[model samples]
Target: MSEIVIRTASARQGDIARRAEAMGVDDVFISDLVETFYARVQANETLGPVFEAAIGDEWTPHLHTMKQFWSSIALNAGTYGGRPIPAHHKHLDKIKSEHFSIWLALFAQTLHDIAPSPEAAAFFLERAERIGENFQSILFK
Candidate 1:
């Protein structure tokens, strides 16, 4: 039974890989990465409350928006249209260097956890780090 279950999971993963190949990335993979990463952020002691307060009951919509954002970034799909700067402006008062560091670390962990390969993870991390830096500079400057 365990072996069968493992094979089933493996087969599902193969499907994800094939789908991801279509877009140069598996959309499901990106979605899972975002979902897992935010779950960590929500559970994180420092980041959780800040996000919870900012997000409140809007997590569903927020997650959808985020997925779109990542899809746009990773696949050049043009899926997201929102301005990230204004969206993050509300948290400017609460965010700090340390918070950005924590955010980057969590993001790195997420990439590590779900990325298809180390190179793939690094690609995502590079973009994430740049984004984080941009946000920090704009918010703190």
Candidate 2:
């Protein structure tokens, strides 16, 4: 499969080859990712409460948004069109940098658990790091 894999030029510049490859996963699309990811996130000691509080019983919509988000990210489907910044803005005062870090950690761990793939899993974590850092910057600002 490595021959079919393509190395990303730079993660900072929208490296998405890994995502593209992962998109071929028919059984596990954005919905699966979100469903599986959130389950692990809820069980995670560090990230669960924060997400639960922010999400409450509204995890359904959030899950849908996540499905769209990852779909846009991996499949280039552009189905994700929500403003997380504003959503985060609401309860961000309760969040800390560690929240994002732990979230990423758990996300990476979850990805590893679901399907073992060097390139795809690494790309997911890389994107998480970039996006999490962006959130942290905004939070601290």
Candidate 3:
């Protein structure tokens, strides 16, 4: 038998996914992000009440869709393709541009806590930034 070697380094990508999955990121990341985001949104003077009212009866389905969205992005699951622009367009009517920033910040912070790699944390935050920018542009522009 040949001698075996063990490495203790983490890859920028693979380890991130592994750590994230172990942290329940694949299964719970999105909902956790959304719940934190919504709490901030609900406490904001400009957007709080709007989300509380308009988001009524839509929590579970919305959370399901968000999980599918995140899994597809983070795991190549291809589980999401819905036109969320329209779904968010309605909410944009009541929110300020700054609301997206708050969402991104909270999302990044949450993922950072659970992410296993800088790359993974960066990947998640970058996606959140992109989504916030895209949604704000399409709806507010």
| TM-score of every prediction relative to native | 0.82, 0.78, 0.69
Residue lDDT tens for model 3, 51-137? 667787677776777778887788656689888888777776577787777767667777666665576677778888888889888
- Cα error of candidate 1 at position 83, Å: 0.7
Each candidate: RMSD: 11.4, 6.8, 7.3
Top-scoring candidate (TM-score): 1
How many pairs of residues in model 3 come into backbone collision?
0
Better of 2 and 3 by lDDT: 2
- As a whole number from 0 to 100, the lDDT of residue 42 in candidate 2 is 86
Ranking by lDDT: 1, 2, 3
> What TM-score does prediction 1 earn?
0.82
Q: Which residue pairs of candidate 3 clash?
A: none
Name the better of 1 and 2 by TM-score: 1
- Clashes, model 1: 2
* Candidates by TM-score, descending order: 1, 2, 3
Collision count of model 2: 0
Clashes of each: 2, 0, 0
Across 65-110, the per-residue lDDT of candidate 2 in tens digits comes to 8878876776666687788877898887668877877788778877
As a whole number from 0 to 100, the lDDT of residue 62 in candidate 1 is: 93
